[model samples]
Target: MLTSKQKKYLKSEAHSLKPIFQIGKDGVSHKQAMTILDALEKKELIKVKLLDTCPLTVQQAALEISMQTKAEVVHIIGHTIILYKESEKEIYKLP
Candidate 1:
């Protein structure tokens, strides 16, 4: 779990980032989860977009992806969600 300050810091850090992946009409699939997990491992922090064509709610998609990838949900604004997971490479230090 992340502290409020930590989440706030992450949200600010994520503000300039573009969504690296999108959940479309197909919703979150295993392959999508794998890709997200890989990205999380490499980048530690990432942004994902829920397309207008997606069937799931933003909360649902964020929860599902966070659970599947074992990442933290740092923020959700509009259709974008910010996720983070600590990686062996140590790219970021949580606030």
Candidate 2:
């Protein structure tokens, strides 16, 4: 689990990032999970948007994706969720 300070820092960092993935009517899929995993590996932090057509709520989609990709849910605002994972070679150190 992330500390409150870490989450706060991540929230600020994510503010400038564009959503890298969108969950639509089909909800989360294996392909999406793979993409998220890859993005997390490369970037360490990512944002995902839950579209209006998505069957799950922002929280649900975030939880499911977090579980699949083994990433932490840093924040969720409106329809967007921020996720963070430490890359083996290029980990992001939280303040």
Candidate 3:
């Protein structure tokens, strides 16, 4: 879980990032999860978009993806969701 301050910080940091991943009608797959994991390692924070064709809502997709990848859901606005995780390499931090 993230504190209010942390969430606020992450939200601001993610504002400039474009959605790097998307969840469509097929939902999340194992391969996609692995891909996201790799991205997370390098980026630490990212934005994901859930298309209308997706069976789940933005919030649901955000939470599910966060759970699968061990990241945190910073926010879900419209069809966009922001995610954050601290890099083990310490190359990036979630603020």
Best by TM-score: 1
**TM-score for each model:** 0.97, 0.94, 0.89
What's the alpha carbon RMSD for model 1?
Answer: 0.7
What lDDT tens digits, residue by residue, belong to model 3 across residues 1-95?
A: 89998899888888888999989999887788889989999888888888889998777777778888998888888999888778877644545
Clashing pairs in 3: none
Model 1 TM-score is 0.97
lDDT score of residue 38 within candidate 3: 91
Of the pair 1 and 3, which is ahead by TM-score?
A: 1
Q: Write down the lDDT of every candidate, Cα atoms only.
A: 0.94, 0.92, 0.84
Cα-based lDDT at residue 13, candidate 2: 86
lDDT of 3 at 52: 83
Worst 10 residues of 3 by lDDT: 86-95
The 10-residue segment of model 1 with minimum total lDDT is: 86-95
lDDT of 3: 0.84
| Better lDDT candidate (2, 3) | 2
Which candidate order results from sorting by TM-score in descending order? 1, 2, 3
Q: Mark the regions of model 3 whose C-alpha exceeds 4 Å error after superposition.
A: 91-95
Q: List the residue pairs that clash in candidate 2.
A: none
